[model samples]
Target: MPSTILRRAACLLVVLAVLAALQACSSGDSKTGAAVLNPSTLSSTIPVTRAACTPFGAAPSVVQAALDGALNPSCEPGGEKLERWADSDGTMRDACLFEPAAASTAHPLPLLIYLHPSLVGTDLSLDVTNIRSQLETADLSGDPDRPGFIMLAPYGRVGTRYYPLPDQDYSPGWDNWYRQMLPDGQERRVNGTTYAANVDAAAIDHYLQLVLAQGKVDRRRIYIMGWSNGSAMATLYALNRPQIAAAAVYSSPDPFGAFNDPCVQQPVVGKPKDDTELQLLNPQLPIYHMHNACDIAGLCPNSLQLRDSLASAGATLIDDHIIDASLKDVAQCNALCGTDPLANYAGLDAPGGYAANLPGYAIGTVNHLRWPSSRTVDLFDFLRDHPKP
Candidate 1:
């Protein structure tokens, strides 16, 4: 048997080795055959050009004004389209509220939380007209057959990157907060941009808490949808929070290597070691994952992996459609997959085939990133069928 000091030294070596492996995977690069990011040079905010939000106008400002008008009905008392809620870290977040035009007095309506991609914050970051046009094309805003539902799209912090530090601390020159963990299992406040402990999850919880207090929401019928980074966050939130009945995520990556914590024994992809800080979420949350085969940001394979993970946890995999570049083929693909293909494959001409080899998941292809209106309808239908118990 080894002495106590030797045992401790061995444990330290094992921890260092595991951390080194994880660092390499997270950074997408490696040094001396080890993957890791330069911890000392970590910055909170990365510069990203704000997406254009022009709607029926040449200038961005004009489009923003139009979006404001659409979201905030002129007849409302406050004349405010959004209600703001603060998180634990004192960050004031806003959510756009869309009340149904003719809600029945007896039935409380379902709520759908829409999370935008990491380009610009708010619904107006992209061309307001373009976004609105897309929503209209999807039939999400004006659907006569669906239940009366309220839509809320919350704005995340305006930064290109997200940090997953152990706790929250403020640093000058960095707009976001970070948390640091000491060697003794104590959390310390470090000055700089650190990782948020599931900032998306915390933000949703904050929004839900505030909405519930208003007494207009049906607690069992909350649904979520997100794009890109927002999509990944949405999936994470649904997996961890039982209140969410269903979720839709598009073009997102895995969350395994992003954080600095150890893994928890839930239901993750690989057989992650016992010391990892990432937890395996075991809830049976319904999820709709959409991705394009040629997605430049997140590869289609990653989305398949996520779908497989969800299925392993007993969640229903409603449908997975892959988009290629051939229009004719895309139509055929949608017909075969029982979902639309042209919506996400906006530019491509549908040539690629479905990634059917992905384990424990369904796969399809489209030409681009915009999923069809039918896909959205299917997701909402799934949410309606699986109310929270």
Candidate 2:
């Protein structure tokens, strides 16, 4: 064959090779035929296996100390292992994880992150709420369809302030919100910009990422709950993370900075600038807010205002229930107390101790500390029904 003929044959082969390479590249695109060649698809399909958490031995003592308001407290819930992760600021943070035996990659459990209140840590919160028991019951129920949950209770950093109510208790608080008194005495609001710089928020985000990496979490059913100040944290977290399925809180303070003169008198709710601030909350997210009638911080009015505000913003679903705290009926304890009417109020200062017995403070503290009685509402049922759509 002539040289020209050989060269023409080589050119034809090179053109075919180029066309084949182009076809391969096109197929690699996520929008094209086979996702096998796509890097995104490959990464997504690969099963992630994180090492099982090591069990922390000193769980019981830590719990008791927290309940008694010990000067130094560390969070380690009973039977649950402590998980430590570094914050964005490189400070190590602690979390207690209660993973059900049924939790596996094949049967991932719904993840519920519990944020503790101002003064106490994870152990006390879990103890008082009895949420761990509830989860255990569900897991051991022998029902395949209703697998239990994996709870991750992350510890908030201890605050600098010395809280002096019902005797001095060490305060471990979240940076999600901070109250500031306005110029006109008695009015207070959460510092909008300052609270945004929350380091705990960053740490909580990292905590979530670590839990998800374990492969035993159902991402769609991720929920958060909090009590008192922690409830405020939950509100901010849900707002920041729209992917959250729902938020169920107890005695949340004014999250929107709308309430003024809290606890001093009847809190007055004022409108936020425009509706933009209020609309930041995902309208589709289900919120179950339970507040006691006579709360110490006067938070009931705040809950009512938030409910009305969300409604005006076209929120898809929000359940707000104000439990009647006036009646200390043992019947209303919902088995939280066994034959003793005051069992629900255990560990708290007795009725006449210090200033805690001041009128409403007697039973008011009990009502605030206790969860909404199951007779009034079922929080678990609400959580089970609402997954991220």
Candidate 3:
């Protein structure tokens, strides 16, 4: 990497401070409260080395043991740091962890491992992204007085990416785990750093086990919500670890992978040719996939292939969440079909209904929708519906 780029990376904290100041100005309450970093800006900052992630100079074992009982699950809001692991390089890595205060020992709580989306941008850094909103709104259970939840949100990369793209370095060892294998063999780490779909998944597993050992968690209820690249990561994780309650993925690219189409210069869309391993894991694992009719990158052509493949591999229910809109701009869309063009299509399956709805004069792009309306599809309710049954 160039000296300029390294310097830029090192200046992450400065960027964070600027963002913090800007956020303070925007919120109008400069001195009070904290930053509000949702799924979009979570990638604003990140730890350079794995060791730097471990706070306080604690060893991995020490960190794990100290954090095992760090949380108290409860209906009332409460949380704590789960774990901090430092690699041998003395280069530490940090993480984002939040848990609702312990409700009661007798009433174990559910755990929701939330994965933020990826922002393919310049340098990565740990910012003053005030996570107050995340802390308050992390619980999607919909019951204010309901049992609490354990929400773990891992940071995505602004420099590299959350999931493997056509351009990033992915290890060959992850071939079976990740269906999107590159033609040029596996992806190698740059400077001993391995960033792949499984990397985040593995971290989730480690922290989840720590909480599980505490015995205050309900092993039966563990859910995951992933958007964009995070969606790909969550789906890939569920393939092997089916026991993760119910999962909801949003803004997923077409076929089996990719952020932009022609990924890595070649589009790796549709299901994998060899999914014998996925078939053995838990064919009945039903995952919910929501996307736009005309997807982004190059996933538009065979967007439904992922859903179809998952069904063939053993998913019982693949709920199709599609955002139906004309390929034209807002003006053009309204001129041809009028406002609420998709309102007429009730409970329409994405691939089919969306295709049939296109006007004869349609000309433009039709990609993924922001989200399937909660009235039509509530992913949170879906998660609650499945509890390790």
Q: How should the candidates be ordered by lDDT, best one leading?
A: 2, 1, 3
Q: Number of clashing residue pairs in every model?
A: 42, 0, 32
Name the top TM-score candidate: 2
Better of 1 and 2 by lDDT: 2
What lDDT does candidate 2 reach at residue 381?
64
lDDT per residue for candidate 2 within 43-110, as digits (tens), equals 11111121221010001101123432333234444445456665444455677777767778888788
Candidate 3 has its poorest 10 consecutive residues by lDDT at 120-129
Best by lDDT: 2
Candidate 2 weakest ten by summed lDDT: 53-62
TM-score of each: 0.52, 0.61, 0.50
Off by over 4 Å in 2: 1-83, 139-144, 160-170, 178-197, 258-281, 315-317, 326-362, 373-377
Off by over 4 Å in 3: 1-81, 86-93, 120-145, 156-197, 259-280, 298-303, 325-377
Model 3, span 205-240: residue lDDT tens: 555555566666566677777655566656655543
What TM-score does candidate 3 get on C-alpha atoms?
A: 0.50
